[model samples]
Target: MSKANTAQFFESVKAHGFVRRSAVYRWMWTNYDDLSELLKEARPSWIVIARELNGIGLRDARGRDLASDNIRRVWLRVSRDLEKERQAARAQQRPAEPATSAREEPKRFNPSRLPANYRPDVEIKPQPSVPATSGPYQVPASIDVSEVPEFYTRKDGTVVHRTQEQRERIAQQRAGFEKETRHIDRYILTQKAK
Candidate 1:
């Protein structure tokens, strides 16, 4: 074909599309933060994260949508990157591991570094039970009376004062609404600390 004809043909091909590996990687890096958040759930199935990545305009150079499989590969790479970063952070915070020795000597542990609720394996001595006061309000003996607030807002849009009836009602409400949790207690304590 003539040079002009060849040029015309190449132009049309360029206009149509040109998918490439470099382009996909470029797009992934451009949208790294968003992809990390979407994939942070760590769920085994990455179909959802891949779909979200595709939806956010990460595509082939030809402007075609990214495949779930392709996005999954990128997701795995990004997950590895995150893990590496996490490991690096932990390494910075912690002392380097000592070389293994023949002896099984105990390592020193800092009490300040322990988690807020972490308890050492030890027998807890039971306290002598205090006799319950003859009244409607039965606050836990563990809670100091001085720390109890005189007034607080309730979820039902009512403000309660430290009256005998209100105290009893508050105790009952607390018993009913306060559910025990495994992980959230630390978060709650953090919020209170702030």
Candidate 2:
């Protein structure tokens, strides 16, 4: 089944990024006629129009309700197109009358504003709150590794440990380790000649 036809959607979603705008244009282009009909019906309301779009699974790219402005833009375009169609039919069927003034020009239909306090009949359930328990981690008092000061050597033969004497011995034990480094680093390189 098409998402637009069956998926549950939010009222006016805030679409950002390319994906959302693409969805909007896709919905607009695909459902153009349906949207126009919704605008033309008696007792046209923006909220109702938005709801109809929602029914078709239209929403902000983020899956949230679309903003009113975005919905209004589409609504305005549909309503304007409808008006143009009506005017064209009138012009074609009825012969030309007196030269029309600017006021007579076919203007965009102004649908009544939705009631200020009006809200959708959606059941808004309170979001589940995470328990206020301590996070899944503990702050240790210190990272003191007092046991033996274990060490590891890097690929470049550099030794890392809690003491200089241990690092020196570890460095000498390796075949490719540099002796001069031990001298400069005061690691007792004298005893390990070659």
Candidate 3:
């Protein structure tokens, strides 16, 4: 339909208060052309259209009196349906075309066209292979490392070692930790008793 006819049809839909998804909408679809012509001849407001619809025993899909909002929503839905129908018709009228050329062939790898820096005379050398061990490994009897130092010297020539006082403090902390762990174990076994 042309823009003018579409506008007329929408106006008629608004003026007639056709309910969406109801028997009235189906009826309107069937008599669209006649309604368009009638709308063009007489442009009525929503209130007048509602009164006429009520007089003719016409109501909305929910059996209630049609309001302006309901009529506007119906018009919107009808317009969308019309646009979709027009688009579908246009698509059907056009012919489909292929996207790619039928004469083109797939490309293959060409090694002869190597980079300028590539030298075919240079031979590639094989790397040395180490034997693979499969079973669980056995530990060495002993690892001798007497030459290894117990403490490392700093850049200022001072050895980093624990003092006598620090060693005594660490031993006391370890003893206290062991005592606390034993007490916790006993408490747990006795159901948290002191």
Candidate 1: where are CA atoms >4 Å away?
A: 1-52, 99-194
By TM-score: ranked, best first: 3, 1, 2
User: Taking the tens digit of each residue's C-alpha lDDT, what string does model 1 give over 106-151?
Assistant: 8888888899999889999999887675444555456565555864
lDDT of 2 by residue, 95-194 (tens): 7677876668686645466576777779999996644523322212243333434644456754445455556677777734566566666755554663
Residue 145, candidate 1: how far off, in angstroms? 78
Q: What lDDT does candidate 1 reach at residue 89?
A: 98
lDDT of candidate 3 over 118-142, digit per residue (tens) = 7678689998764453422311224
Compared with the true structure, model 2 gives a TM-score of: 0.27
Global CA lDDT computed for model 1: 0.67
lDDT values, one for every candidate: 0.67, 0.60, 0.65
In candidate 2, stretches whose alpha carbon ends up further than 4 angstroms from where it belongs are 1-20, 77-194
- TM-score pick, better of 1 and 3: 3
By descending lDDT, how would the candidates be arranged?
1, 3, 2
